[model samples]
Target: MSGADRIAAGGVTAHENNRPPKIEIHGIERIFLKKNETNGAQESFVALKDVNLKVESGEFVTVVGPSGCGKSTLLFLLSGLASPSRGEILINGDKVTGPALNCGIVLQGYALFPWRSVRKNIEFGLELKSVPKKERKEISDYYINLVDLTGFENHYPYQLSGGMQQRVAIARVLAYDPDVLLMDEPFAAVDAQTRETMQDELLNIWEKTQKTIVLVTHNIEEAIGLADRVAVMSRNPGTIRDVVPVNLPRPRRIGGVRNTPDFQILSHHIWELLQDKGSRGGSGAQSAAVPRVDIGEHIRDDAVI
Candidate 1:
């Protein structure tokens, strides 16, 4: 949340105006231990602390931070995969207490079954829910095409490339048609070129499906390039530092967006915040402010309750 101004990348491009958020989070916290990471006395780790955020429906929100920060912790909480020790999360005005079917997730690696073909993998969710074969086929085929894997529908996970497998993973989620998409470093395993392609495909799917999205990544550029709003978090016992709106325009392609003036400005601003944290000797107890200069050139202020 440092500088919200123009970036230096290929000269930052101006972004659109900020809008109200769709998903709301308040005073959330999560604690974990190896149960064995420490044998003598399972050492406890507080991964998240008082993380508050709001993501508007259909908005693309990206969470970025250093390793061990609670980015993934927050994602898990939102999807109801993990329970929080404290706080509340609301989706469509209802508080979340457990896993809900409407939330689709695409984690860091492809978790598809090796024995299943692309189409069957996509249909798996439906099968569990008792969706009939005809409807399952319809939904699965639709998503396969949506992810541009129509011709590869019969291919098994072993036959597809890493990138291709990811496509199928996405298609499976698309078939689920979750209103909110939760992705944890979904492209971290792919090479740079393939990563870019996956990012592009993500945008297309998002635009077409209009699903609310929350992506967790350690990459700052990726955060700025894909998110409508980038939420920065502090280290362990993590808390959100800031939520900066990306004003970059639409129909934006990946490479072009990265080189924009706005991207450079925001990237530097965020970089500065990270640097300052190091300089200031960041502890888990960081200030509520995420570093950022607003679009109006006015700085943002906060007081975490």
Candidate 2:
């Protein structure tokens, strides 16, 4: 199906009707000026151009692309950490002017404080907001358990494993109660087993919280498995090639779905989209045409998988 048709056919949930998208990117372009080492002259490099996407409230959208495709740059714009040279981004009907508490960002580095215990680290945002100490403890306690880090509340970052540290980072963001969650390669640092475990845990948490999430990843399977729609991007003046809807059933287990025919099909399709030579060009219309077939129709043909 085409991206527009899939969206009209329920890429967004029924309840989101009549509401503005939770996140909207319209005609966005970002440029950076760099000095040439050879001549000491400045040149403008286009990092992203003509990017547009809409993420519904409570939606889990993943952006996937090859390296240097401005995936991280897109996240920074959404978080209001950077501005686009043109176009605009809106969150819940308000234009993103600067950093605000309503959105929380989690990075792959697990930017937890080494000096603080897990409980303290999770409560840091609440403390900055001047939430009462009693209430901060209550909030921290809830998220610690939510991310399954209840027993290790008092442990320091240095004492925990990589996965545990990441959980702490997630709980910390959730404790702030942001309406939107932006993640940049948040699981890339972990072992494969741990990454899958984290993906499952994140889905469980999303089900309970229903926060709108936008995650950026280079891992195709991870992008397909976790998102309601995967926004495939192209590099060299980055642009969203297509937003592919994932029709897989949820309460999804990352490992459980990996070998399924539908999963493989979606994976193969996204892989092809990334690898398609047309994606490297200025226009994405050619690459977007590849997903027009009904994905299920390909399942019966064994060779397709």
Candidate 3:
């Protein structure tokens, strides 16, 4: 086998080794009420239907689907920010009752306390749990360094750049030492270059902390690059269509991976799935616009795993 193929095959073998699931989602469905524009009547909107997934301990999973596909709704349900209309979600075999301290959420908007300094913001959760002041400072210092915002501890959110602000948000959550990290399009607002940097930084941090992460994003490349598996969801009344294992090697560089044959093949596969959904009247994410490659297109010679 080629080196890349060996690495890919080994990853699958390792994954297949039986382990208990850290998160179990069974027959989950979410419904919402929306006002009908035509008759001023409340309409029941089925955002998700019968969505089932199991994420193994310490694995990184990303969920991707078109717009209105209930991706965010699923995250909300998992976080206990909202309840499923039907079915159950369990963490470590325990039913999710409400927003517990074990789950940490980093939202798309950065959601930082503008009035607080970076150090103070990172200490917010610790303060809420009434952690000792000395312990809180120690935890804050560790995560701030982990996210690489060491010197900016005293700076306010307004003073930091977009990427820096997001780092503070991440540090705040990490300070609480949650078992699962739920990120909803956290890098969507940053510039492309900064976004890639953040991606690398995040993977580094994920390695260091070993937190089970479930991230929701509209970006196809981002999903494949970061996740051990990508959960592809279908349109409104969402359901998981596939769980695509990322066979690429670890220590992936996002820019380099984008040009690899393996990466292109995987990316094309996902693109086709989304395109097929779009042709069938399923609206895709506005954030992703992967180019269509013809069968005759040139494949790069020096492919990287």
Candidate 4:
């Protein structure tokens, strides 16, 4: 086991606390073989190294890091779309052998079929399951309303905006009734205003569905605002540097929460951690303490945790 893995293993365990984790990633590593075009020499690139994590049932977790930090790779591992070269992943206490029905994934690209209408797209999964037409329509209608896309059901992907298309994608995933939702930068392509709205929408959906969600994004503010715990990762070998819990009250709106003193403190702390890791060449063996700084007056002193 790697030093980083050892540190992670010693952290709070769900089993130790008598609450089993809904999702557990144990000592995972992903390696890709790259061939040099000039000499045809093959080299092994370590995307992730001995990564460990645990998410309680219905918990919202976000993984954030610089590009090439393997945040998306870890999500892929969890979804069973890609297998780790080492370690094991478990969902609901069962080892993930392949892509299971309990997992639903939403990618950055909308991936909606251009030929299909919004309602039809949302019902695609149910169609695969051979659900009756009336039942499929019922499930699709429920998710459409949940996502606020009720009136746009007959519209096509190109007929809708980027945010709308993404909502359709999310509703389609929910229609499948997966126990967990794995989103890989689902709002990266949307505009700033739309992204914020989508974030709020996603949180509301999470609350309503109560499904365990794991999202990977490069945006620090998005990570902090949407997650109960934000897992900060280092580059190079792509090990998790730290997991910062968002202590802000729930029913949070980005406009309100982002301006809070507590939010600023945690944001700065995470920024420092990322910067420190970059300066140290992304070595997970050495852990550094995050320096807390007071932004200004009017913010709670106890906000810096």
Q: lDDT of all the models against the reference?
A: 0.75, 0.83, 0.80, 0.82
Candidate 2 local Cα displacement, residue 230, angstroms: 0.2
For model 3, state the Cα shift of residue 167 in Å. Answer: 0.7
Over 1-305, each residue of candidate 3 has an lDDT whose tens digit, in order, gives 14334434545653565776889999898889999999999999988987989887889999977667788889889998999999999998899989999888998789999999999999999999999999999989898888899889899999999999999999998898889999998897888889999998888888888999999987788888898888877665577776667877777767767787777667666555554432322334421343423211211111121
Cα error, candidate 2, residue 266 (Å): 1.0
Q: Report the poorest 10 consecutive residues by lDDT, candidate 4.
A: 294-303
Clashes of 1: 27
| Candidate whose lDDT is highest | 2
Q: Please estimate how well model 1 matches the true structure, expressed as its whole-model Cα lDDT.
A: 0.75
What's the TM for model 1? 0.84
RMSD of 1: 7.5
For candidate 4, the TM-score is 0.86
Q: What lDDT tens digits, residue by residue, belong to model 1 across residues 11-63?
A: 22212235444578988888887576446677767888878887778889899
1-305 per-residue lDDT for model 2 (tens digits): 24334433555453358877899899999999999889999999888999999989998999988777799999999999999999999998889988888899997688999999999999999999999999999999999988889899999999999999999999999998899999998898898889989999999899889999999988888898899899988766688887878777788877777788677767777766676532534565643454524322332232123
Quote the positional error of residue 210 for candidate 2 in Å.
0.4
Runs off by more than 4 Å, candidate 2: 1-16, 277-305
Query: For residues 1-305, could you state the per-residue lDDT of candidate 4 as single tens digits?
Result: 13333333443443366667889999999999999889999999899997999998888999987777799999899999999999999999999988999999997797999999999999999999999999999999899998889799999999999999999999999999899999999998898889999999999989888999999987888988898888988766788877877766787777778887677767776676666533433463442332212211112221222
| CA deviation > 4 Å runs, candidate 3 | 1-15, 277-305
Residue pairs whose backbone atoms clash in candidate 4: none
